[model samples]
Target: EPEVTQTPSHQVTQMGQEVILRCVPISNHLYFYWYRQILGQKVEFLVSFYNNEISEKSEIFDDQFSVERPDGSNFTLKIRSTKLEDSAMYFCASSAGGVHEQFFGPGTRLTVL
Candidate 1:
């Protein structure tokens, strides 16, 4: 079965540098989303994209963050300037439709120091 794939499973960056997390969802999936989990916190939804546009976003997705599908197969999340608080395991997910069920990637662990 096809699954979501994320590059650079782990990343280390400076606090103020930019970072782009990449993910390729299952080819047949329609909706894509980004979620993050802080060390001891619950999973938090960041944003969702569909039909080439943002369908929904949480307060965490602010002016400093952006999502894009540069190509039909790749979905990307860009954080303009990293912060110590931004360090977490970011997961990329996709579902066939609506919010019924979502398949998640292995997650990219980002460390900002």
Candidate 2:
């Protein structure tokens, strides 16, 4: 079965460095999203993208963050400078159509010290 994949399930880094979390969403899906969950906290939407432009972004998506579809299959989230509060599990998801169910990957756990 086809599934979304993320690299380095756990990433540990210092507070000032950059980090790029990668994902490859399902091949036929059209909509993509990124969400983060702090430990013991509710999952929060970060951004959603379609047709190569951002559809929606939450207040948490600040200047330090960016998303890209560098290729047909690869999606990435880059954090220019990490802060301690940036520590969280980043999940990549995709849906076949608007208002459809989103399928999620296992997630990338980013830990900034």
Cα lDDT tens digits, model 1, 10-88, are: 9999999999999999999999999999999999999999999999999999999999999989999999999999999
TM-score of each: 0.97, 0.97
Instruction: For model 2, state the Cα shift of residue 107 in Å.
Output: 0.3
> Hey, what RMSD does candidate 1 come out at?
0.8
Q: What is the lDDT of residue 61 in candidate 2?
A: 98
Task: Please identify model 2 stretches exceeding 4 Å from their true place.
Answer: none
lDDT per residue for candidate 2 within 9-113, as digits (tens), equals 999999999999999999999999999999999999999999998999999999999999999999999999999999999999998876769999999999999
Which pairs of residues clash in candidate 1, taking residues 3 or more apart in a chain or in different chains?
none
CA error at residue 50 for candidate 1, angstroms = 0.2
Give the CA lDDT, 0 to 100, for residue 101 in model 2.
93
